[model samples]
Target: MSTDGVGFGVPWQVSAFQLPAEAPGAAELVTRIRELRARILFDGGRRPDFRDGEDYVDDQELDFGAWHFVGRREADGPPVGYVRLSTPQTGRLFQSRAFLGEGPFEDLLTEEGLGTAETFEHSRLVVEHRARKLGLGVHLNAMAIAAARCLGAKAMIGTSGTADGQDLFHERFGFRPVPGTRRYVERYTEDVVLMLYRAARGAGEYTALVEQLEPVFSTITVTPERALGDLPRAHGRAGSSAVTIPAPGADRRMDAEVWRPVLFEPQRAEDRGELDALLASGQVREVCDTIEEQLRELVRSREPGRKLAGAELERAVGEQLAGVDPASYGVWAWYPWSGRLVHLLPREEFRLVRTDRNRGRIERPQQRELMARRVGVIGLSVGSSAALTFAMEGIGGAFKLADFDDLSLSNLNRLRAGVHHMGLNKCVISARQMLEIDPWLDIEIYPAGLTDENMPEFFSGGHGPIDLLVEECDTPYVKIAAREHARRLGIPVVMDANDRGLLDVERFDLEPERPLLHGILGETTSADLLDLTFDQIVDLILTMVDRERISPELAASIPQIGKTLSSWPQLASGVALGGALTAEAARRILLGQPRPSGRFYTDLELLTRADRSTVA
Candidate 1:
């Protein structure tokens, strides 16, 4: 009856709703999803009772506050795919935590002061073999992500199967392997991986998907009002014993004016007894001794191999242990983007991993100089990637962004976001992506998009005067309009067109009166082209960029702009490379290095010609 994302002459109607276990067709839908999952997971129909039994991992209790998606060829047809998002409480009882024991999940929730009321679980995602090519998996995941965000959840985590390589598929939607929990599932028959996606707090594969599919997501996601209702209690409460999660608002960071030793415990108080028993055993003693010995050796390696041995070394070790408390040993800092809790190390020590590689290349003073500079980026379609690369590499201390356009389905082919972010301003989405990378980072946004009136304010120091500008807008008016302001403000400009690696750099700082685009279009000022027709605009852009030298694909796509294709073709790889190239140029320019303004091409086809010559 519908054909939203269907192909191959199959009209698939995708419906999203919270189906009560007692609903008219709920039981049958669950059976179809379960039977399909069983076949996929175990290679046959594994009944509910058998070890390799049917994957009927569903029930009403688990569906509380959850959204279920069922895709069919017709109104009365069997489901081609199904995916359920678990409610907050049910997410706490997620299988990965139940079987693998609580890890950073409990720690993460503790640090954020979140409860089951602010979490989600992606459970029971299955698609029939025949429908795999119809793009149903992407639709289901996108809808589920949107639904979770709608229900006021901050993050979603779930267990994925490694047996059928679903882990890789999950990565496409931005789900990453939970940092420390990877092990066998159900008596070692299959490997299970815990995956998580924190809504904001970093750029990731899934975040982009969410942004790309935002339009579709807005239509399919069910709201919490209709999804949550009276249902059976959760089957497995995650933390019911002594080592339980404290009720929200209870202070665990301190007690009686003393720092409490935080522990990564998410089980019941009774379960602590089992852990105490294990800690008391000879086995644990051996493990502790092994770790202590390794620590001693590490000190020796760095401390000129100072050999502290015999009673003398034991005395020193005891002295060192006496000054430290057990609680101070494993305090983890949570990184919400990756759902990883990294053990806190010295700032310099932790940063050394990247700085060491940059030492001789970037030099210490230049590294420090780069981090102190403020940069602004426009046009988040490609600008998002550039901004993130700058943040990840510690290239900028502050950032300002501008974009009036909301995320559309077409943008997802490159931008990092999910269905939940659909309809959001591009600037807001990019800024969120940047902040997720570094919460302390200072970022400003221009929601209304850049204009003649605000262009001056955008260039001057509002947050901080931008030392560099990465212009990536598609509007020819803004593109030229931005350079006019940058030239007057003496700011360097860098941009990449994401085709044939055409990077156009304008060093307005050096040549204040230099003709725009190196005078390629006959001294035409931004004002001169303000009233051009669409054909004139297209002709101006083509002539400015030298269409004769562009790649064959780009040249072909240009003339068909409003014909076969709605827009120019762009690949993720090209956009990513453009980001890296722009960052590299910006870094050099910011450091006062010799990166004078000019056009540069890192054409893949041209570079490969040398390789082909060598191969031949």
Candidate 2:
């Protein structure tokens, strides 16, 4: 028997056990193991016969092909902690005998065994009280796992007695609970928790967890203290102080500290200079008061955040600026009164309003009638700009948008939205902008692409189809689908394409046969030209069209450059003209006025030329 004492200068050791016949000192070691177990159970837990005379060493069935790891200290020259592994067939914890008549173990084991033939069972882990806090348990456990892997086990399974212990083991060692076993255990049973460890599976789970946690760590908090320094300062004489008032549309209730720095600060020197100029011009006080009046009227006029349109806005502005100089006041005259800044309005807004006022002005009755129309546009890339133009013109109408692509960084060059809108779906971003321009517009959205499959559903065919279809999708498939569908339903289709600074149009209603434009472009198939091997189709088109009618440079670039002018500025110009012409066509069609029905193209290049035929 062994009589090694704890904390008595014992040398700590870790080793694996082999069959006694393979080791010369096996007999003596077996005797020492028996003494160690007796002393551990008797002194540590007041329980004897813990092994039930099983002579674990003599149990060759358990030790012959299995591995046993023991942690020892020289002071006690005996095992202080140990973990054992055995094939599923030999381990008592997993054997059919240990679970016979106990519950559903037979069926579970049978199912798991079939599903995972490469897995083994771990059993017989015990630690003496002296070794409990010395890391011996963890050390022996790891060694047993390494041994199991060395023997080619792909997965390890084990059971834990307590929920807390099971949670700790799985949390630290990367184990997952086996599902669908709650009904198998008795009401008073110890609730055995089953776990498995697969190295590859563990690695994948670890990666996903890290990805989920990264966003949490990367979040930044913006505070008001940082915002105060960024507010625009008014310019003043050397001895005079400038008193700056919050602009009319500004939400004073919002804590200036939170959004002031990021949202109010001018990002460029020119912006600061402009703000100072406004202050030095002695118009700052009047502007601030005007802004206040505009804010009060806006609040009283409609629901908060709702945009104003048509007569409502004209009347609001008229009331706000009853006597200001329309010219010297600059474009920002409306900034102090409205929540929106003056420059935010499209340049066309001021031009259109002034021109209409000068000409035979549209009567209030006629304006109300025009606003009653509804228009649906597909492909927000260009369609959104068109929608904005129509809204600015006081064309009161229900507006619908359709597109599936999200706003990306590349869109900032031409899109009316800013960086905050990046990653949002285009339909939503555009719809919000439209509503901001004219809240009265009955806005609807389909955040999806219009395909041949869904075109019928998108256009009302049973009762009454949409009055017009504006196709702006750059894709050939969408263009063909939209054109063909609109033609069949007898709905006039007004579509636009951008080439350099020019806008190309194909009016189906003017000449019903003109819907054949899709055919002329060879848009029968869905394949994109971008995916083609060569520019044969484009070359053929350029050769077919009159040389004098198109730009010589553009003609030469077609086969080589294809359509690289699909940028935002080019597209925006096209959409703006398309919106203007489309609204004109709608007015002519509804008013029974004479209008051109065939293809018409407009470009800034044509305007620059002295010869009008260059526009053809």
Candidate 3:
């Protein structure tokens, strides 16, 4: 019933990684594993004919076409244990075939009627001495099985030494001897046994073990397929159509896992052509340079009066950027709409502009609480601004965005986008802006917009339920329609009028039976509001928005629809101000602060009054 930060049911906090040989920390990982193995395997007098170094036996050649998983405690610590899963069709299970005599492992598999195509090999499950007693051995084996399952392996074959009771350990963990493969060994003066554990695709003797490992599987999964924009899981043995390359403009989206490696991969390959061309155009350099400059400013603010020489700053920032692996972050996201990369990794100790300033104001724990909140935004005109602000402050764990409208030229005055995004969907544009700020923030797009047919599903908790709903739609029907779902799900609803900064907070979570919109429209159903005339709709909106307290300009401009103005007046200033106010309110409400159901005004007229105090 207990869980760690990542929801893994382990004795100690552990980070499970499946990294390639060329991954950022792969070299250090390889060295650590080798050292640990040497300390344990050769701690005695010496192993017989061990060709590897006196300290460790590192089959570095085996690293090719193999995935390595290293387990570390408390993140940022030395690897406590390591395992390797290799999906090979031709190669024998490392020196095991010779011991069993003339491909005996494969013959044994054939005799068992299990094909070798869907089979893989797991080996080198070594754990450090200090870390061994904490149930890491069992965890490492469980995670190795998880990795095997993730890679679509139906079974695994390996050889274990009998000297340290490893063979007994493997047998205890569902690994059975290959009937006649147990034999005395000359390799290390220790007996060895070839073992087999069948994952069996969907059903196997180890079905219960697989079922029990569900939680660990979900936690330690390395979703390379989903991470690489829309890359399909590659199948087939070795060379028979085992790879697929994304086409042009297809690599626009990049999640945290895929973004870093995809970016660092050289541009000469045609498979990486989209990014190759972009990098050649000098975009990446320009972007990283701008980010580095901001990081410098952060350093200045963090330690006032401290400065670095121009050359020294460049070298320091350059090294830091090189180490900025987006895949190393806790949260990551991909936004195809705006074509940007986002991750939560800190470089130069500067995450965002408010790093030092927000330390005392918001505090790390408070920000973490805010980040754990799941928010849904239903309208992009104002909701887009709110989403962007929330992302800038890292205030949402995930987001569900719904807006059916496309970005037209007229929307540029209020929406935070340039002319390049003119024809894109409003939700997509908002998502892009949010992702550009923090790509690791999870986002779901309702491209066709929210409807009654899909609203229930939208509010459902698959990843997690919508914690709070921000309703900013102008359509009278949707405004009430969204609240109906919010009320049913007990989700708090926040909306910004973007005029006089009227932020409406409906604490449906606090008052579950509270009437939709506090019954202000007198049970105004969506169907009933749909039949009203445009003038009636205007009157309904004004009544709901409290026209009595609206800004002088907004009040004057509301009634002049079609006569003086083309539509209800909306200003860039008002929209931006509404975004800032709504974000602040949402953070408080999500944190369970005392923001009860009410309409609060951030009226500029009242705040910047002529009789205001002259304090600078």
Highest TM-score: which candidate? 3
- What TM-score, over all chains together, does every model reach? 0.47, 0.40, 0.51
Candidate 1 lDDT tens digits, 1-616: 2544422234555567765566665665444444444443332211122112213343335654356776665555555566887776566667655755677668756755666677788877876543443446656676678667767667777888653357767776677886656765443234577887777642254465455554554565442222222211222321111111111122222111111111233133433443343343222212221324533443343343467787767666555446553223322332222223323222333333334456667876787798789998999988888998998777887888888788888888898878756776777677656655544456767766787755765787354478899998877888888888888888889999888898989998999988777878666677887878878888877776788877899888887989998877888888998899999999889888888789999998888786667654
> What's the candidate order when arranged by decreasing TM-score?
3, 1, 2
User: Residue 99 deviation, candidate 3, in Å?
Assistant: 55
Per-residue lDDT of model 3, residues 196-281, tens digit only: 88765432333454456655654754422211122112121111110111222222221111111122222224324433444343
- Model 2 weakest 10-residue run by lDDT: 254-263
lDDT comparing candidate 3 with the true structure: 0.62
Across 315-355, the per-residue lDDT of candidate 2 in tens digits comes to: 66666445653322223322221233332222233333322
RMSD of each: 21.6, 25.5, 19.6
Residue 362's lDDT in candidate 1 = 80
Better of 1 and 2 by TM-score: 1
Give the distance in Å from residue 194's predicted Cα in candidate 2 to where it truly belongs.
Answer: 32
